[model samples]
Target chain A: MSDSTLTVERVSLRIGTFALQDISFSLAPGQVYGILGPSGAGKSVLLETIAGFYWPDHGRILIEGRDVTRAAPEARRVGFMFQDYALFPHLTVAQNVKFGLQFRRSRPRPTEHSQVQDLLARLGLEQIAERHPSNLSGGEKQRVALARALAMEPAFFLFDEPLSALDARTRDSLREELRTLLRELGVPAIYVTHDQTEALVLADRLAVIRDGVLLQEGTPSEVFGAPVDEFVARFVGVETIIAGRVLCTHDGVATVQVTPERRIEAVDHGAVRSPSVLVCIRPEDVALNRPPAKDSAGANQFPGRVVGGEPLGPMLKVKLDCGFPLTAFVTKRTYLDLKLAPGAEVVAHIEAAAVHLIGQP
Target chain B: MRTQTLGQSRGLVFVFSVVGGLLLAFILVPLLRMYATQTPATLMQIAAIEDVQSAIWLSLEAAFLTALLAGALGVPLAYLLARTTFPGKGVVEAVVDLPLAIPHTVVGIALLFVFGRTGIIGGPVNAVTGFQFWGTWGGIVIAMLFVSVTYTVNAARVGFESVDARLERVARTLGAGPWSVFGRVTLPLAWRGIVTGLMLTYARSISEFGAVIILTYYPMTAPVKIYDLFLQSGLDESSAMAVLFLTASLAVFIILRHLSYGRVTPGGRRM
Candidate 1:
């Protein structure tokens, strides 16, 4: 259990036109790594390959440093929770949890009852333990499936869009619960999902996959802030990428100056080497000021004119016609207070920490 | 346009009624003949006979055995064919279903060749087990199994196919092996279909006359006994046997329908 580290080394599987080509990732013990991609992105295929459902056409999958590329799903001891929560229609909740226990019947363990109860209780599924999956809601069914998978106490876990079937509210809550469970279990979990928010919320590290290839893998903050490519940058919901250059470096921070006027600041360590660098920032993080505030808390102000403001419920998303045309989100009250309108002069004050220093694109 | 549509609808109803009534009569006539009798007590008296009793018992035994045989063998093959990618799957399916297209007499002849006293494996098999198949109950069972079990096998195959293979695979990853997963997940989901198949197999075997007569005429099952009564006794005796069999068959049909359609499964019921 301690040495369970699942690694997929350049595994390539071809199924007709769809394929996972040169896909590689390693799940360290207790870390939840999300494989995020669009539909038809081979995310599910990669998960299935790891679960030993699909034998990859090339490369190998090593579970605990043991090559299990050809092993049967049961032999691999890799628990796969399907998107549909494929709970047994016949077995009661208790029986479903006990199903895997029966497989290891030859050498019966004493911890079966307590472990099963503990898991059911942990999932808040104790009352439903005697009930069947058909009786449960989508979220309940998912928890039962999770409990069932965890009951076996497999080497690692594979979740194929566990939250995709749930409602938005249920998804958010379940994500937190799943995160807690995975941490408690201390087994690496590979979560496959197409939902960007689900990946961001669930995974300690998110890997963006598209058409079977691993585009990028890093912590949520790292991947979201400094995406390696434009495709990944948009995937992480960072729409605005301004081409800026390192003007100067003071106190381990690079002063990146973009456009004719706006000066953006970002942390500059070893990689902020050249004058030419791309400054990345999220639209929501950008601030639109009424009059140019020269000095603000960690905020570098820029001169710009309001091109348009789109009222989205309580918030107003104003588009600034700066050099890069920044989008800033502000409250409707603030928008009204400032009397912001199209062709009006505004200040774009971006926090130094908010400005991301990405690789030159 | 509305009045014309209504007029066309009325005409459609008239045409549909004429066709539907004819179709209903086509199915209902034979059923009416089987149940309609000179008197209610007559069928009861006919069924009271020792030979009639034996024929009914034999029919039950043979059909039950055939169903059991089909279930035991059909499930594994169904799962294998449903879950795996293998060479010659269509060929295997065709071969399994060959009995449905083949004449029952041919099936009898085939069984005779395989299980007869002077047959290929039959001679050695008879020497070892001291069992005779040409006229014994075993021959009846084999012949019944041959035709009856195919319906069960194919239907069960369809049932097994209806279950998503991913469910079983997920169960396997949940620590269920091939056997446990099939038992816990696949079997329950597919049970209703398999049960329907088993019922069909039972009904078919019990009613099967051609193969049973050709294979084992001595141990006359219900259908065979009915045929014999028609030949030896008269139309009256045959009618009585028919009435009795109709009752038994109807009861079985009702039981099967009840078992299959009575309620949602416990899992579904909870929802």
Candidate 2:
């Protein structure tokens, strides 16, 4: 019987200097839950404690209601894939995949052959099955590690930064592949990573951990689109969350007045029409135009002067003081065409659909 | 590949060869004298002595057993020293390798004092056990263990340290318990280096003279037998025993070293 639910309840473990304080979260079966945090955020420690490595200083871990806090890692029946993929160097891909299954004290031994073949094919490692880890590429090693973990038919999957060690290109592709693989197999998994983009793309729900404390956990939209606090809000993105009042509503869309006397409209939530409401928006949602000809149609416009602008890769993130100083994202090409400089008068036009009214105030 | 640098390289090579040749001369000349008196028939005849044969076998057994003890005790200590960081880690590490610098005779005397009848820890231990370690196979084992502990401890420590801790963490998350992870991932990877260390320790123990001489001069090992034969019989008998012991110990050492480095086929053929 496969357990689809992994519950970590108040698991507090202090490893060295980092202390995980009463961390708790539950993941539904077949969903990839990512533990996301900055470096030294106790993210890896949390994953390890749940996997039964570091004995929790307090609390219990329940896999579908059974307390496994004191259980051995192998006895816990969880599969852990590491950032380096940690393929056994001496073993071929086939042998590596068969490692966990071979240890089962069962009636019939799981043959090294078929289990290897099935998982290798599943992970597209069939052709490379006979090769050692040192011979495989990064993506290939990642797959081999995944294959090895999955071959055991584990109760839950634990991914400790599976894509963190890969080159950028491989990480991008493998993230999608890993998410798809977990989904297709319907294996409940807990993934830990510092890479926010990977968490955003791969996790069904994101648990934001910082300094060993779980700051928040929700669906990607819930965690990212509707973060809980100031740090989470900034970590999700460097944009601002504004508390404002719904000045008016037309055809179910309400305009909220923001700080620095700017009005923004979002697909209205009934609660948002109250005296105060909070709207979450990313810098990418705002576009800068030269004073949008006094009044723009089908757009929420606010006049602001560019205070700062920086080009980072394909996008230009500009700081604007449209009332409240805020950042707006545009293409580098767009920045150049608009000649967006500091103190430049620009109209910040926001798409109504992009203004995310997160939660009740 | 410039002419000036090539000339410098050649000059350096000449100097290195000269120094190496002198050192080889210093080592090989004395060894050649030890074997120079032997003829084939005399070698065969003297080597056929049963007492000398038994002593050599005893020495080999003692060395092998001692190496096994070192491997069992030293690997875990090495692992702890390598993977963990705690207060006085450096002090602990230095203490583990301290035997290497200490004279083996001092070790034998220390073992004797500790395990000797009226000695500090030895008195209680001997009284409790009623079994003697003095002049016994047990004493030989203790002597060899003391002398060779650094071999297994240092090499296996480096081996364990070479492994990424992240891998163990991964194994843990993979549902492998601490013990299983150690047995599966940690032990297997470090086995090669540990085997090499064990073989080297065995070689050193087998060839040891000073410690064995100090502790148990009886139930004579080959080195002891050779020394006794030199005093009692003469050079011919002593040289024969020496050659025999040397050949056997060297052969086993080479075989162990080869086994450590080379792959063995399932059918027992070393590749």
Candidate 3:
């Protein structure tokens, strides 16, 4: 009953032994909800179900407040872009775009002809409109698919790994254009991808799905900043997860004891019912240096030796065994300034907010 | 191992060439000799004869109709076999290829039992419509279709299989119905293979002798007529008929192959 553009309520489906259990989410107008997961995680299957390709075994699907769970794909008024861009191989580029336009049930707009032409021109496909899909490059095929979907003027768009088939160079260049285009359309979209970077770049809100289960859903920063479980923490690039026991909670902060003499302060996520919890920290959030000034107070600092350093482009991943293992990504300049080879002593500084608490171990 | 010089094996080459040459000549010599037996003037004269002209005309018409019928009935079945998994799919496929496995003469006799007058379905059909299949053009078409329909079905199946299923699903999301998706996406992409099937069906139908002779002999097809003439008149008359039929079949085959690649039209935009 919410006023979201699309709502999937308590959907469950079983295909053989694999089952998608109790998936529920809603999308507001003009919002892009990126479903990020690895391959075979039912990301594409969920998209297809929302588009009305398959009826869920349980639950309701609504588009713009109308229930369409049992409706056919064409009747659902949902535009879908497939992973491979699925442009009709026999049709010319113009014909492919015009295909959806021909099926519009409403009155013809005064500028119908100009609308298709404008889309082709907007996608930089005016010159290739006469050519068949077999003659198109990967990026061109993707644009053609987008144009075809847009021509339908559906209630919302569902994209399934739209850029996964493109080469790395084409994907990088097309990502920005696609982002701008989706924003300009001002319609709700659900973009599905297995690549975390793609999801982070394109999603307003994100959901990390795993093995047909909805693991986590929130804004990109919320999910990336504070993952709810170890699977998610690792999936989102949080390399350092320390097992700890919650010693106490005061105000909104909780002290989790990592070792016999060491303790770290983290924002107390209300779901921490158990005495034992996992302290999650991202490598990029930790700062590595010799030591802080005496005036700098209330900084979580630890002295450790650099066990290994691997250069990752402009940064270095420094592995340290400080009583327990910890990893930090330092800038190349920091790595060079420290001259810190193996067994070199260095201090790692972490702010109170940088340490995130996961309620479930 | 040492490499042998090209000129060092001239004697061995001569022996090999002589054997290969004889096999090639074995096929070409008979056909060439048949063609050379008729002067251009005699070929023209023989083509104008009433019996010869009618028999050739019947053969072409029946084959063309058979191809059209096969395409209409077989393409959908081919698509089904290509896309879906049914319980008896293997059995269905094996039956489609059964024509190729069995002898052509046995196929003729098999058709007789099913489509003959007083046969199972044929008896009821004749009783209701009063149109007999035996010794009629209907019989000839059925006979030709039984043996040649597989070529069309298998070709169309290959064509439909090559089309990615994602294309159809994408079309559906674009507001196209199932029929629209097939016509706009599946059929056109698979056109070349379907055309090849049609060509094979037509050629097989026209050249069918045993089946047509058994099912319908009154409205004589070209092959049956040529055989009859060979028995009554001589080799001269039959060879002249063979040359004429071969030339016509070749012309049609070449035209089909040429048109297959250039079927691009403004409407379909086929590649």
For the candidates in turn, chain A alone yields TM-scores of: 0.86, 0.85, 0.93
Segments in model 1 whose C-alpha atoms lie over 4 Å from true places: A1-4, A55-71, A75-77, A105-111, A183-188, A242-279, A291-320, A323-325, A335-347, A351-361, B1-22, B109-130, B256-271
Give RMSD to native, each candidate: 4.8, 5.2, 4.5
Q: Please, what are the lDDT tens digits per residue for candidate 1 over residues B214-269?
A: 88898889889998999999888888888787677778778766867664563567
Query: What is every candidate's C-alpha DockQ against the true complex, given to 2 decimals?
Result: 0.49, 0.34, 0.47
How do these models rank on TM-score, best leading? 3, 1, 2
Q: How many backbone clashes does candidate 1 have?
A: 0
**Candidate 2 RMSD to the correct structure:** 5.2
Q: What count of clashes does model 3 give?
A: 0
Compute the DockQ of candidate 3: 0.47
| Per-residue accuracy of model 3 over A1-361 as CA lDDT, tens digit each | 6789999999998877877889999999999999988888999889988988789999999998999999889888788888878887667899899989877768486666888899899788999998888788777887898888888888888999988987887887778878888888787889999888789999999999999999999999999998989988898889899999998889878888899877888877577888798988889988777754333456467778899989876678999977767899988788889876789888877777888888664
- In terms of lDDT, the poorest run of 10 residues in model 2 chain A is A268-277
Docking class for candidate 2: acceptable
- Candidate maximizing TM-score: 3
Best prediction by lDDT: 3
In candidate 2, what are the lDDT values of residues A208-256, reduced to their tens digit? 9899989998898878866766678778884867777777789978878
What is the Cα root-mean-square deviation between model 3 and the actual structure?
Answer: 4.5
